[model samples]
Target: MNIRQDDPAAPHVSGLLAFHLEELRGVMGEHAFALDASGLSSPDVTFWTAWREDELAGFAALKHLGAGLGEVKSMRAAPSARGSGVGRALMDHVIAEARQRGYRELYLETGTAPLHEPAIGLYRRSGFVNCAAFADYQPSPHNQFMVLAL
Candidate 1:
């Protein structure tokens, strides 16, 4: 598997993103949480994609929030890519990019669900711990917040 920075609008990036959202709807029973794929397509955001044998597996984006802070958006792997380290690979790439860019911290909002447990574990293992909400997101029973200090 290979993970690197890329344009979020690339055909593979878009497909992984849609696949991620569709899976979210299935797990959350609705489109409760959405990754702003459009924002990822912006030039202001730093995006990354993970590939395995040239197949699009997952992608992540860092939306610059100024003052060495960034929000991790649109980090997800296709269903077939889950549990195969694609998510971790993408996250590691994004987090490292954040630190390299001199960000003090990285934050994210994910779902709170039995199905989301694996993702929760992934974040924690990557040095993220529970944190208060950041950016425009507010406290909601459906969302879980975490941050990692670089």
Candidate 2:
């Protein structure tokens, strides 16, 4: 798979971004934290798309949180790409980028719902450990926070 920094607003990414947001909202309702295209396009965020030849396989983003800190955001593998290592590849790419940017810690917030189990497992396997809420997030039963010290 080839991974490259990408624009969320590009035609190639719009459909997947819409689907990702819709699915997250369907699963978590108001508690969903996945960003929309506008959010991912913020100046502090760097987005990437994973491609298998001409097909878009997945996407993920890293948000600079200032002071050597970074947050993982908008990680989603296409339905057709799930279970084929796309998620792992995206996670690895984001982590490597965080390290390269001199971040001392990488953080992420995900849901506690069953729909999130696979992602939580992936995060754990990638070295993230449970942590208290960070940044602007409030502690809640619906939210699970994790961090990896770089």
Candidate 3:
């Protein structure tokens, strides 16, 4: 698989992103969608897309938060691409990008439900540790926060 920073507005990327949002809505409800800023135009944010040969494999984003901080957002592995290392590769790309941008820390938010276990495991294995809520997030039973010092 190959991963590269890409435009989210591309046709295939946009469709898969919609699919990701639908999946999130089904599992986490509308409140889960509240923090999404994927559709907005922001100079501080960048989107990455993963591909296997010609197929779109997955996508994730990094949002710059200044002060040597960065946030991970909209990470999604295509259902067909799960377990084939798409998520891991995307994460590796994000981490390297954050470091290249001079970020001293990287943070992310995922859910606490069983459905999120795989992702949490991935983050943990990638050197992230559990942490209190940061940025604009509030404490909530359904949310799990994590941070990694770069």
Estimate, for each residue in 26-134, the C-alpha lDDT of model 3 and write its tens digit: 7777446322444523678888889999999988888888899999888889889989999999999999999999999999988877878999999999999999999
lDDT score of residue 89 within candidate 2 = 98
Model 3: residues with Cα > 4 Å off, grouped in runs = 33-41
- Per-residue lDDT of model 2, residues 14-100, tens digit only: 999999999888987888888888899999999999999999999999999999999999999998999999999999999999999
Q: Return the clash pairs for model 3, or none.
A: none
**Candidate 2 has which clashing residue pairs, if any?**
none
Point out where model 2 deviates above 4 Å: none
Evaluated against the true structure, the overall lDDT of model 1 is: 0.81
Each prediction's TM-score versus the true structure: 0.88, 0.98, 0.92
- How many Å off is the CA of 119 in candidate 1? 0.8
Ranking the candidates on TM-score from highest down gives 2, 3, 1
Residue-level lDDT of model 1, residues 7-112, one tens digit each, is 7666657666776777777776542556556777776688888778878877778889889998888787877888999988888888888989999999988889
Better of 1 and 2 by lDDT: 2
Candidate maximizing TM-score: 2
Candidate 1, residue 119: lDDT: 84
